[model samples]
Target: MRDVAGSWKDLTDDANFMAGTLTGQVRDIAFVTTAVATGDLSKKVMMDMCGELLKLKDSISFARSDRERPLDVEPVGGGGTDAV
Candidate 1:
């Protein structure tokens, strides 16, 4: 028989690499969004990503500089900050 165990290990390693990359992208995006939410408008999605995510990254980057971006509205009839 062939060395099937080695092939299996290789496949597992590939899968692990892919999964790690995907999860890392997610974590990076999350961090960037949180930073933006805290008024860090300079944050952008700079992680490696796939097709749709490439578009999303571009969108996020655009929003970072888009002057038309919606401002943070205060809560209506509730406790909230008055800062504009």
Candidate 2:
């Protein structure tokens, strides 16, 4: 019937929209990752993606925070190691 065809078309359209959104998100994340790998740690991902894509965004945020944190401590005054 005509109604069935219309419903199917609508379903396919929704699927296409979701797929495109997911693809774009994935590519965005990939670019962020590449940038991070190339010593650019300031990049972050923030968006209202669906399902696990949201989790991926959250993980990327955490990674950025961790990367930005100072991991080394320099000795105070003079060129010498701290008395440990």
Candidate 3:
């Protein structure tokens, strides 16, 4: 059971790492788009960066929703507790 718990922790860490990396990539693309739009860079480059940024944003939203899902729990025993 200890080993299983350790493995689960490792997996959670990896998922967090991947989410962070996705967010970082989105930020980098936004930066590049701003730099390009300032007339110091190319329009084509800005467009490409914007496209990648949008994709990353969608992915991040999905990941966040998945992470926030409510856990399933059951009530133990009957009648003694007050019902809300």
Give the best candidate by lDDT.
Answer: 2
Task: Please provide, for model 1 over 12-84, each residue's C-alpha lDDT reduced to its tens digit, 9 standing for 90 to 100.
Answer: 8788899898888888788877887788887678787879777777777776778447789867656665645
lDDT of 3 by residue, 1-84 (tens): 144567798988888887787666656656645654464343222222246566764554454455457877677555468665
Q: Ranking by lDDT, best first?
A: 2, 1, 3
TM-score of each: 0.66, 0.74, 0.42
Give the TM-score (vs. native) of candidate 1. Answer: 0.66
C-alpha lDDT of candidate 2 relative to the true structure: 0.81
Ranking by TM-score: 2, 1, 3
Better of 1 and 2 by TM-score: 2
- Expressed as tens digits, the lDDT of each residue in 27-70 for candidate 2 is 88998888888999977775468678888888887888898998
* Residue clash pairs of candidate 2: none
The better-scoring model by lDDT among 2 and 3 is 2
Deviating ranges (above 4 Å) for candidate 3? 1-4, 42-84
> For residue 84, what is the lDDT in candidate 3?
58
